[model samples]
Target chain A: MTRAAPNPARRIREDIEGRIHSGEWKPGTRIPIEQELAARYGCARATVSKALAELVAAGLVERRRKAGSFVAHPPVHSAVMTVPDLAELIAARGESYRWEARAILRRKNAGGADTLQIDGIHFAADEPFALENRTIELAEVPAAAEANFAAEAPGTWLLAHIPWTSARHVVRAVAATRAEAAALATGSGAACLQLERDTWRGDRPVTHVRQLFRGDRFDLVAEFQAGTGKREGN
Target chain B: MTRAAPNPARRIREDIEGRIHSGEWKPGTRIPIEQELAARYGCARATVSKALAELVAAGLVERRRKAGSFVAHPPVHSAVMTVPDLAELIAARGESYRWEARAILRRKNAGGADTLQIDGIHFAADEPFALENRTIELAEVPAAAEANFAAEAPGTWLLAHIPWTSARHVVRAVAATRAEAAALATGSGAACLQLERDTWRGDRPVTHVRQLFRGDRFDLVAEFQAGTGKREGN
Candidate 1:
């Protein structure tokens, strides 16, 4: 199959998106008017208008009637319910990533079954980003009992090995405890975002994890339609 | 059509749900064993087990292999993207709700169009719950210019008067600034959950709002299936 030429409108949209994403055009910075952009790109004014309109719909730009269009403030949005791999997330942001296993323990549960508990810190760009505590039911995933977590985060390992059928997320804000502050290198009572998650395979629980993120470093975003209660671009 | 009798399992589920909701059974309290519950309710052991399983699925109870089930810790969960009426939310919590409009201003936008700005505080049980700042585009909703915000919250009024087609939400955790702390009746540097929302009617922006919620008072919850990218029960 032969590829078709890119649409001019889409090309212009992507070009503007790149500028915004690259921080070349900061929020509230006004962009060129339709006529100027059309002249610069050798495209019709209508094409540039279409590009700007699409950007507005995508929440990348805002248009005022008499004033020109301007870049919209960028709020990093993440799917609230998805289990994102922190390593991949950091890498995607062009930051160095590191995982340190602070502690790991194996113990017998009330049912005399083996369980593994892990405490770790995820670093982005050599700075602590999140402190994580995770527990795995060894009976459900016996390999976890022997798996070496020093080299990898348990969340990364579980996402690779387990086929989770369902998940629940509880998100809250909290003051950083002294222990959390020391681990995250933040002052005590600093704001933190706490996310508690549980994943299951069919009827069996796979893992339960709690992650505390530096409030300044993370946030969650979701877009919704009027009646569907579904997120945009899902 | 006449409603059929409720299923016995569902009746049992609702009974247990009611108990949890009423705070009669606190978290970590062990519930009766299947046999004991069956005997108490005059039901089969299998029926009681089914009810407990359903409760586990609902995240209301947790079961261990050899240990009996226990009530799970409850976290108040709100939809992160939904524009909930704070008055209703507080009322549903059995708290007396009050809306106090701190300031209201009418200004002209860059395009020489009217805009309305509102600053308000929401109180639940006579304690400050949230500090809110909102801006409404008068061109989009002229009725807002005359609405008596002192008597009703702008959010509740907007929900009743306008039909928003889409909305974007950005959620973050932050330490409260002095001004916010004063309004929220919390200490400076206290953790707060900040939610910024922009709603649009078709392609026109209708309103933008920022609300700072006391961290100890609120949280969000979402449940999801493995692959659909859709929230459960949505």
Candidate 2:
């Protein structure tokens, strides 16, 4: 065979990914044998094997020792998540909203939020607001967080970003600190609500969020279609 | 004209999306004008206009006044995401999945640990014997939190049966509160690290995630590919 040059692994991986992306290989469908991939990519069997390994690392395909490498699923959602102007979320529901950025600190990588958002951005911390948190009216959205949420809460504001979307939320029990817990309201071991949400508009994720609802107040409500057969899009 | 119960707007949108996903409409290609789409879809200009607007809302297309609608940049990744079993995650890497159920709350979705989870299995806030919050070690899948992570991080276990091929991630900054700040080892006014991930294998959105990191000891890394623009699956 007039062989292709080096970077065989890259070529094979790309080829496999392209096939899956193009729907030539559907999720759960097995890939060609290592022997077959080698023949097609014009590389040694080991190189083809390595390419499959790379796909595994990328979480694009699965390898079953005897069953062979198979496509993971199908076209997964491609989320274009954005920080919605808070006011827009609330106002969309015909509700009014407000905000306040408490104790703003432009920190490089601050901790305290949920794990999903940690690798995402460097935030400007809070200030001038009691409890060192931002509040919102659930009605207005300027370019960014604005006003003091004396009357409105940030959680309420942020959650309104999407209408009739699907979410997987988590509420947990945690020990609260003196200042921070007091700020968001609740008590130590009082078990504040740690609400994490992966909000989706169809399959496109609108936002992934983790919030602490005051343990003292606030409740979680989730209503499923039970058996809608197949869920519909928003 | 013999029309087939024309939904010109709908057809136009599907055609554009098909072209984009099928690699016919390359990225950054300026889409045709409303008049052009009208001609192609055999519909009035307004019909084509509506279709494009809908695409924009769906995050699959973008328009720039006179610039016209073009396919928005697809997410860099095309991984199928799934809500996987934490044990499966680690075991897949040749490890063990272990955890202790701290508590299971049953409620109408209000207050404390019962406040966040809403799927109605109630929630078992678990303490992972081996837990990975923001970072899932490749050697060890760690724990993926699906809902009430305080008791049981869902990533530690799989609730649904789906295969994933790709993963999408987003990060951002948020202010910390007393309770959450204390748990994450940050100050009330400090910035926190957040990570949101959506994973896929093929076309299905198998899993959607939002993870918060202990900002004090977290880092986000990026591995870029050469400029070979591709297409989005979902």
Candidate 3:
């Protein structure tokens, strides 16, 4: 069997990126129409459009339905986010991990903050485990999550059910509150790792969760690739 | 003024996604070719190709240049990652954040474990600060980094110059060594927050950095959107 020809669309994307990086196509400059780009590249208009779409997704250009596409001004500051598997994490360290669903409630509070105010251990396995308090506003909880939470734990169910477009995470150390201490069987006011996460589907908010880990019990790990300066868009 | 017509490619994408969700198109099932899909959609073949490309990028389907596209088999586990700005964090807490470079050096070792060892504090702001010990393998350091390390800290310089496509971060609690204690002015063996991060540009590794935050000084925050089961692709 013969090998397929290289994708011209990818090449077109690189060419356009080269021009932008070289300052030949400055930021805020309007790019040629898809039809014109097609003619220049000797490729189909759809190929040019596909190439342009990638740039748009990468935050390099802005496309108006009629006004056409223009290079985007650089953003002030930017960051990226990722989520991990708790079971795999524990197993990796040769520890047995177990998750139990204690209770699921449908709460209606515009305040969007529901602290897990418990006076006893949430889950007491052979070893100590952390209590992850997930507080999501009703408005932010999606329909699928509503259905899934009835059957599975929030974190496990959400990961399988939703394909999130973007997310943000913040972690800080806080003195364990009375509730956290009772649940983890630890001393009050001990320094613990508190992770707060909120996720979205495009512009639609999904859920906001706060997980408190026994400082001695858990850790979070993440890995990524850096965009080469020339092709770095978003 | 007349509004531009809706993008046909996007409509084609939604249509294809609907079929997949409805089980008309099952996993590992080969999708129709661009020509056939275009004819069915009553649009240009390029439009169908563009639509298919989106599915391919979103991890819904796999496309072979010579063959066609097929729905992807389910993955075992998935994880997402993000990077946060430290300065913005300190400022948000109303504490002034300052970064001072104490030393930069070049060493060759395949072992890839080099802590930011020092006899004095690296950055002594008015308020207490976290001492991040980042270690990168020499092979992973890019040319830009080799030049930048001579002047500034790795994390500070890399964020401004390099664009990473992906990264992995691992957060764990560990006993601070004598060196870390001296730098942060904390007691040795204190349970500090240790963050290990490795970033890549596509398949090529960029840097592996380990940062130790004075447990009391910092926290991490993350937010994300779940992929709706229908379009749920990695």
Among these predictions, the greatest TM-score belongs to 1
By summed lDDT, the worst window of 10 consecutive residues in model 1 chain A runs over: A74-83
Every candidate's DockQ is 0.21, 0.04, 0.28
Model 1: per-residue lDDT, tens digit, B1-234?
222335666777778766664447767778988888877767777778877876775557889988989877532222223235666567667888677887888899987889899998988888999988999999988999999987888877876666334677777899999989888888999999998888876567889999899899888666764322233431
Pick by DockQ: 1 or 2, better one: 1
RMSD of 1: 17.9
Per-residue lDDT for A1-234 in model 3, tens only? 222238878888878766664446766789988899887878888778878877766556778988998876543223333345444445555666555545555554555643221111223345656676564434544444335443345565555555333456677655577877777777776557776666655575566667677777666544332222221111
TM-scores of chain A across candidates = 0.62, 0.37, 0.56
Reference-based lDDT, residue A93, model 1 = 78
State which candidate, 1 or 3, has the greater lDDT: 1
How far does residue A233 in candidate 2 sit from its true spot (Å)?
9.0
RMSD of 3: 7.9
Q: What TM-score would each prediction reach against the true structure? A: 0.63, 0.31, 0.59
lDDT of 2 by residue, A29-66 (tens): 87888998887878899778867866764457778997
Q: Which ten residues in a row have the lowest lDDT in candidate 3 chain B?
A: B225-234
Model 2 Cα lDDT, one tens digit per residue, B51-170 = 776676455677898767776764222111222243443455454444434343333322222222212111112322221233222211212323444444455433322222345454
Sorting all predicted structures by TM-score, with the top scorer first, yields: 1, 3, 2
Model 1 residue A198 distance off true place after TM-score fit, in angstroms: 1.8
> For model 1, what is the alpha-carbon lDDT of residue A215?
94
Residue pair clashes in candidate 1: none
